[model samples]
Each structure stands twice: as structure tokens, then as C-alpha cells.
Target: MITFSKDFLWGAAASAPQTEGAALVDGKSPTVWDKWFELEPELFYEGVGPEQTSNTYYQYKEDVALMKKMALNSYRTSISWARILPDGRAVNVKAVQFYRDYFQEMKSNGIEPIINLFHFDMPWWLMEKGGWETRESIEAFAFYAQVVFEQFGDIIKKWTTFNEPLVHVECGYLGEAHYPKVVDFTRAIQVGYHTLLAHAMAVNRYKNSKYNDGEIGIILNLSPVYPKSTHVEDKKAAHITDLIYIRSFLDTVVHGYFPEELIQLFKTHQLLPKVEEEDKEIFQRNIVDFLGVNYYQPLRVQRPKKEQFPAQFPSAFASHYDWPNKKINPYRGWEIYPEGIYDLGMRLKNEYKNISWYVSENGMGVSEEERFLDESGVVQDSYRIDFLKEHLIMLQKAISEGSNCFGYHMWTFVDCWSWLNAYKNRYGFYRIDLENQFKRSEKASSLWLKQVIVENGFPMTDERKG
Candidate 1:
């Protein structure tokens, strides 16, 4: 009974660094990820770095043809800042041509391109200059954004400013899992504020440009926070977690302000982010045109009973995150709550006036790809199909209840490199044989997705089983 509109965009998402090879070719400088791999390859899972991934950079024309076979009407890919601008200061002409050709090919193949400006791949030069912590890097990011808008604006209309800013803040700044390895909360907050400011500045710049029909927005990994227990302390902890994790960026981007709870929390902990009065007006004046919600999992939180961490713990949001023992997906080490998508959709509807939105990224990652394959190279990924079905059912329910979700684009198009996990956790509908020259084979989920897209709804048991 669940039916999507015929015009609903159905495609996959990817980033340049993950899908594109030729990392240093055509005047491209090294990104932080490349530098991180060079510094310590041991940090990544299975010792896989971002050298040559799915090789989409060279094979994009063939890849677009494959997308046509898959019946995708839209596709999402990021432009590498370092690829376009070797040092994040000057645009590389050859790199620009590569992207222009790539976008034009996608369009010629009847695919709408959703281009994101930044996606976790910071230029190494910028990282050396303090990355997001320094204002200079923020300015450089705005410049990069403006250059991309001016150059590719004619071909790409759907633009995402930044991909998963919270992940950038949490993983890089707080968790020490990503690059720059800062565990201090004060720096993390500052980085978050600067990222938001940069996004706003880029939005304003794009809005005033000649591409009047082009839309610019920010992509947030909005995981709804849930308390493990019904206790009042647990509830309060959940609220604070949501405030710091979700509302911190949501309030700034959607509502044009920071959450008062977050401000008070930072004040209480003596770890407030450095913000200027003038920057506040910049954010307030330039709200995004749309919101891209990347839902993967919900966060489980509980009250912290132990003493707070020392003030010098090198993360931005110090003494805040507390997690109680909860059920987790053993495959990916992430919580697997499906209802979180519904809760997030409702929250966005009630709080943000039902703004135009889309499920930008959502998928499950599996460590072992061989388990799903048969002798014929066919992968019966019923588990992945079930995962998508469950989440989409919840999404369909939300839509029926009046949530203004425009479309859904999964986390990836094909199995590509994850930042830290590298090639360990495969999350692609089309499997790429890494041992070979990255030959791709369509998995069972790819066909399932095609049917879903073509039919514009969930297939019945008889139709799906076939």
C-alpha cells in the first residue's frame, strides 16, 4: 500500500575520495586522509587506505551507464576540495574539467547529480594550518565552496555544503578515531561553530550567484538520542545528549541559533566554544534552502554517575557523553533501532516547520561480504533488503502522517572506502572485487532497489521473492 511518487529521486550516494581513484593525478594535492594513511596505516581497518578505491574517477562514464541499468534517476557524489584546488587556495583547471565532464555525463545519462562540497576529506594543507580549528581554514573552505558553485553550478543544481558535520566533530575532535587526534572538548566546539559558520557563508554566497534555481543545504547525520531507562536522570541525560549532538547543529542551521541548553552546558563545564557576535548574525541571516538527514542509528544515553573528566581532556565537548550498556549490532558495533528515523522525522516536522528534506544516507555495513555470495557471484543480501524495508516502512508511516520528505538516497552506490574502517565493512549494492582491478558485480539488493524505484513502492511478497 505504500507508494512513492513517480518523481521521487532514487539513487545512491558516494564521496570522491571513496569512489574516485587517481588521488594525486591531474594536479590534485593530498588530503588529510591520504596523509593520515601515510602517517599510520595501522589506524585503518584491514590496512586499506585511500589509494585507489572503486576507481570511479576514471570509470565514471561506464559507472553512469551501470547506474542507468540499475534504473537510478539521481546520484550523489562529493567534489574533492583538494582535487579542485590543489592547496585549497587556487582552483586546478584540469581537476575542474574532470568534474565538469563527470557531472555532464551523469546528466546525459538521465541522472540528476547531487553534489556535496565537503565530505570528511580535508585538504592536508588546511589540516597543517589547524584544519577547522583555525579561522583561516574556514575562510579557505568558503573560498573553495564559492569556486565550486561558480564553476559547476550550471550542471549541478542540488548542492550539499558539508556532509555529517557531527561525525567530523565527534570522530575527529572527540573520539580521536579520525585525523588531527584532538580529544579536547573546547576545540571540538570551536570546530563545530566554525563549520556551521562556513556552511552559512557558503549558502549566502551560492544564493547570490547566477544559479538561481540551484539549491544549497547542509547534510546532518541526525541520530535521535534515546535513554536506556525510564529514570528521570536518564531522561535528562538523553535530553542533554540530544541537545549537544543533534540540536547543536540543528538549532544553528535550521533555527539560526544555538540551543540554550548547549550554551548552558558548555558554560557549566567551562568549555564554551569561542564565538563572535558578528558570526551570529551571519548564521541568522543565511539559513539553508533544504535539509539532508543522514540517519544511520539512534544513540543510547544514560546519566553519568562517575566524576567528570579532567578539564584538560583534549576533546571539545568535555564531560558530557555518557552511554549505558545497551543492545548493539554486533556486525557494525552501532545501535540498530529502526524507530529512530520516525522520531527524527517528527521532530523535524514539528520544530522546523516541516522543511523540505530527504533521507540522504541510510544503510547497514557488513564486515564479511563473502557470507552473502553464492558460487555464481550472486549475493542474496536478504538481511540488507530487510534492513532497508524496515526503515522505509517507518519512513512511509512518517510520510503518511504529514512529514515532508522528498526522497531517499542510500549511504552509498557501491562498496567504497570508509574513512577509518576502510574496506572492512562493505556497504554497497554493487560489490567491487578489490583483489582484481575493482570489477563490480550487482548484488541481489541492487535488483531489489531497482524494483522499488521502478514501482515507487515496496513490492509484495510474490513480486519481491522473484
Candidate 2:
């Protein structure tokens, strides 16, 4: 009974640094990821670096053919900032050709290409100049965005300015999980603000450019926060967590302002990031045309049992956020909460005026997938199929209730490299055997997705039972 619109886009997402091999070829400068892998190989899971990923840079045509076979009408991929602009300021003509050709190929095949301007791949040169923390780097980012808009805007109409800006703030700036690791909350706040500024600047530039059909927006990973209990303190903690994590960026991009709680928290801690008087106008003037929500899981918050740790937690830590007691799926540590999707849809619809949105990234990551393969070489990844089905059902309900959600693009097209996890957690429909020059093997979930796309709804029991 669950049916999507006939125009609903079904596809997979990938990033250049994650799937593209030949990291150093064709005049491409080293990115922060390249420098990180070179300096700290041990930081990655099992010591597997970004040197050899899914090899999609060389095999994009082959991969695109595979996507067509999977019945995809749209595809999402990021253009490496370092690839196009070697130092983040100057354009590389040869590198420009590569992406132009890539886009042309997708268009030729009747596939709509959604291009992301930046996807956590910071140029090493920019990092040396203070990266996103410095205003200079923000200007360089805007310039780079303008270059991409001018060059590829003819073919690529849908553009995402940044991917999961919160992840970059939490993981790279605050948590020490990604490159240029710095665990200062104040710096994290500044970085988060500057990223928004960069996005807004990019939006301004894209709107003023020659492209008539182009649209610019930012992609945020919106994880809905829940209260562990109905207690007043628990509810308050959940509210704070949501403001700090989700609304911090959502409000700025959608409503053209920062969350009031975030401002107060920074003011109380005396850790407010410096902002110019003119910056507020820039943010207000450059609201997004759409939003891309990447939903993985929801968080459960409750009152903290002890004092805050010696390490400075950004905001009030009177409470803690923890996952609710539920059956955990072993593939990925995230809890399965299908209703979170519906909740997020309703929240966006009510708070943000239901701006056009799409599920950018949603999937389960498995530790070891090769063991689940059947005799015919198809991996029986029923868990992934179930995960997608449950989420899609919620999405259908939300859409039917007037959410204005456009489409759904899964986490990835194939098993690609995750930042610190590297290849440890595989999250792809097409399994890539890294041992054999990255051989591609379609999993059972791929077949399931193909039928879902073709039928525009959940497949019958007989279709999925076999």
C-alpha cells in the first residue's frame, strides 16, 4: 500500500574522496584526508588508508552503468574541492574537464546528477591557513563555490553547498575523529559558524550567477533527539541537545538566524564566536532553496548522574543523551527507530515551512559483509533491506501527510571508505571486493531496491520472500 510519486528519485550517493582512487593524479593537490592518511596511518581502522578506495574515479562509467541497472533515475556525488581547485583558490583546467565530462556522461544516460560542492574534503593548503576557522578560508571557499557554479552549472542543476556540516563540527572540530583534529568547543562553534557563512556566501554567488535552473542548499544530518523519560529535567535536556546539535545549523540555513539557546549557552560560557555586524545580514539574505536531511538514528537524553567531565562540554551538562532501551541491530551500533523519520518530517514541515527536502543519506553499515554472501555470489543482506523498508514506510506516511519531501538517496552506491572506520563498516548495495581490484558484487538489497524503484513502493511478500 506504500507508494511514492511516479517522479520520486531513487539512487545512491557517493563522495569523490571516498570512491575515487588515483588521489594524486591529473594535477589534483593533496586534501586534508590525503595528508591525514600520510601522517597517521594508524588512525584508520585496520590501517587501511584512502589511497585505494572503491576505484570509482577510474571506473565511474562502469559504476554508472551498474546504477542504471539498479533502476536509478538520479545520482548524488561530491566534487573534491582539492580536485577542482588545487589550493582552494586557483582553478585546475584539467580537473575541470574531468567533472564536466563526468556530468555530461550522466546526463547522456538520462540520469539527473546532484552535485555537492564540499563533502568534508578540505584542501591541505587551506588547512595550513587555518581552514574554516579563518575568514580567509571562508572567502576562498566562496570563490571556489563560484568557480564550480560557473563551470558545471550548465549540466548540474541541483547543488548542495556542504554535506553534513554538523558532522564536520562534531567529528573534526570537537571530537578529534577526523583530520585537523582540535577538541575545543569554542573553536568548534567558530568553525560551525564559518561553515554556515561559507554556505550562505555560496548561495548568494550561485543565485547571482548565469545558471537559471540551478539551486543551492546545504545538507545536514538531522538526528532527532528524544527524552529518556517524561521528567521535566529529561525533557529540558532533550531540548538543549536538539538546539545544540540539529537546530544550530537548521535555524541558520532555514530561518536565517542562530538558535537562541545556542547563543545563550555560548554567552554564559564566555565562548561566543566572533561575528561581524554585516554577517547576520549575509545569512538572512541567503536562505537555502531546499534542505537535504541525512537521517541515521535518534538520540535519547536524560539528566546526568554525575558532574561534567574535566574536558569542557560545550553547554549545560546537567543531563546526558543516551539511546533508549531497544533491540540493537548488530550491523551498526545505531538503534532502529523508524518513527524518527516521521518525526523529523513533521518537525521540518511545521518549523521550517516545509521547504523542499530529500533524504540524502540513510542506510545500515555492516562490519563484515562477505560472510553473508550466498552461493550465487549475492550477499543476502536482508537486514539492510528491512532497514530501508521501515524507513521508507515512515517516509511514505510523512509524504502523504503533506511533508513536501521529494526523494530518497541511500548512503552510498557501493562499499566505499569511511573516514576513521575506513572499510570496516560496509554500507553499500553493490559490494566491492577490495581484495580483487575492488570487484563489484551486487547484494540482495540491490535487487530489492531495484524493484522498489520500479514499482515505486514496497514490494509484495512474494517478490521479497524469494
Candidate 3:
């Protein structure tokens, strides 16, 4: 019997390049995703690239119709930096018109758009100039942010400065998942710092814009860390990992400063990113209006006997392990921990000032979801429906205790291209039928969610069968 606020946002999210696949059409240039698939075709799942996607670029009208059918009141989508500025500085007039029309269409359908400025699809041209790691790129992003505010600030009431900046730094600099695959955490630190500075600048710009009442914030993937065991060593490991992974971004965005211990750890390794004195004050001045939290899985860490790689990344002092005998999502290979959602809510209530927040991206990604399709054109994705129910119940509990959350947007509106896994795991309320002209079909979860929105809660347990 979980209920939500009356104004709770019921919707889904998708990014520009992932869904809108007009790769190089009508003055649109390639993004890093396009160039990556070009350089490393084998890296993508089934050799699929960014160019072949859900074709929302042309099919936006039809898609908005589907959103209305699902009774969605909100939809989050990113404006493709590449589409907006093919060459990264000059605005493309045609793309501008396209977005204006698309957004207006959604509004006409009674769907409010939660627009994000950047969503990992960095313009390939921008990446060439040292993307986010250089001060020049930071300034470039701030300028682009200003342009977005000036152009769409009136039509779009809700805006996100950047979506998951940490993922960009981790994948691009520390991990090998993204383009320009490198493993230098020193460089990762620099990218992370510059991104925060960029976000602060954007927040400041938004406050000063003509549409000052419009909401602008940044989205973060805040997966909490847990100790593998009660041992002191394991607890220490979890704390260190939390400081690096979660607090490094959260503290700065909320409190306007990095975790002091994290900075000291970096200093011990002589790996701190170059910081300017004025930049510190900038963050202190412009904290976010709201927080967009994307939680998928929590990390469990165990203390290592010694430094695993002192010569490698700056914070490689701990080891991460899986929760013992944890229930797992067989499709995406992530642990199923619904309680983590509740824990996150309580953390915000107790510690993070209970600032307004939303479950911006929390959905299961499954493989070969089309197998469950019936003759009537519905994919019987009962697994996804159950997954949402479990998480939403926790969210309901959080709300009952006052977490200041107002929305819950599933990861995507339609199945779109993932970074490295491409189309391997499908996470959409609607199915993407590749063989039948990129068709979009309804899934069981969409119908179930529609009812949840209609009721503003999961039906009582006895009525669930109804």
C-alpha cells in the first residue's frame, strides 16, 4: 500500500544521441559516441553503433503520443550537444528548430520536459580540445550552458546542468568503457574538478538568467558503499571508497567543498587536481536547487592488507566485492537491493539536509526482452514490473518519513543505445522492434505504471490482482 505525493512526477528519461539517431544529418556533427563506434566497432554489443538507434529524431511525434497514452506527466531528455553545436561552438539553426518543435509538442500533450544539457554525448569536437580536463573546455561548457538557458529557458521550466559527470570521468579517464580509453586517475581527478567547476558556473549563470525562477540542477549517480563484513578493516575500506566515489561529488555539490579527507588522501599521493582559490568560493556560492539521484547498485568493499596499486590510480587502496549471496538481476548482472533505495532516502533525511531530490534514473536493463512479446503487441515484462514495484515501495517509505523527493523517472522512455553494451540490455517501457521498421511496442510495465500514476500509489495488496 505505497502512496506517493499527488504531484509526484511519473515519467521516463532518455538522452539525445541514444534515442535520436540522425548521426550526421541536417547540420548535426558526430559525438564522441559516433567517433568511438567508428574507431572501435567491436567494442559495441553485436557491432551496433550510435548511428542505428530508436530514430526518435524523426519519430518524436509518434513517441510523444505514446508517452501521453502512458499518462506520463514528465519526460527527461538531453539536448544533444553534438546536435546543438555540430562543431561545438556554432549553433545549428535546423537542430534548434527541431528541439523547439519537439518540446512544444510534448507541452501540447500535457507532458513537462525535464531537459538536461549534457548527457555523456560530448561533441567530438569538444573532446578534441581535452574535454572537461582543460580549463578551456570548462569555459566552453559554461558558454554552452548559457546558450541553452537563453534559448530554451522559457519553454523548459526544469533543467539539469549535467547528467552524471562522475561517469564521464570514470569511464573516460579511470576505466576503459568510454572513448579515449585511458587509466590515469591523475587525469581523472582533473576532469572531475573541472566538471564541478563547470557545474557551479552553470548554476550561477542560471540564477542570473532572465528565467530565474526556472529550476536548474545537476544529476548524480549516488550508489552508496557498504562494508563487506563487520570487520574494522572492511569498514575502513567502505568509508574510503565512499569518500572517493560518492562524497567526492556529493560534498562539493551540496556543501560547496570536496571532502577534506579525500583531498588529504590525494595530497598524500601528490595527485590533487590543480585548484584555484576563487573556484572554491564559486562552489560555496552556487549550490544546487535540487539533486537528481541515479541509483542502480550499491558497492561492497573489503579492506585490503596493503595498497593494491600505489603506482596506479590515487585511490586504489581498497578492494570491492559482491554482497554475499545477494539476489541478482540475471539480465543485467546487478545485485537486486531494494533496501538500498530506502537507505539512500534516510541518508538524505538525516545528513544531506533533506534537500529536494528525485529518483531520476532507476530501472532494470534486461536482455532479449522481446521474447516475452505476445500476439497482441505487448511484451510481458513482468520482471520489470516487479522490479519497479519493489523500488517504489522503498521510495514510498522514504517519502512517508520525509525525504523531500518529488519525482521518479525510469531510466528511459524507449530502448536506446548504451555506451559500451549498445543494445544488449533493453530498459524501456516500450519495446524497440528492429526488424519491424524500428517499431515501438507497449510493454507490461508501461500499463502497470499507467495505473500507478492513475492511483498515485501501488494498489493495496489485495487489489494488485485486480
Query: Clash number for model 2?
Result: 2
| Residue 95 lDDT in candidate 3 | 89
TM-score of each: 0.95, 0.96, 0.97
Task: Please state the error at residue 409 of candidate 2 in Å.
Answer: 0.9
Cα lDDT for residue 234, candidate 3:
87
Candidate lDDT values, in order: 0.83, 0.85, 0.86
Error of 2 at 64 (Å): 0.7
Please give, for residues 195-293, the per-residue lDDT of candidate 3 as tens digits.
999999989888998877778888999887889889898888888888888899888888888889998888887778898879989999999888888
Residue pairs with colliding backbones in model 3 are: none
Query: Compared with the true structure, what per-residue lDDT tens digits does model 2 show for residues 341-375?
Result: 99999999998989999999998898878788889
Candidate 2, residue 262: lDDT: 77
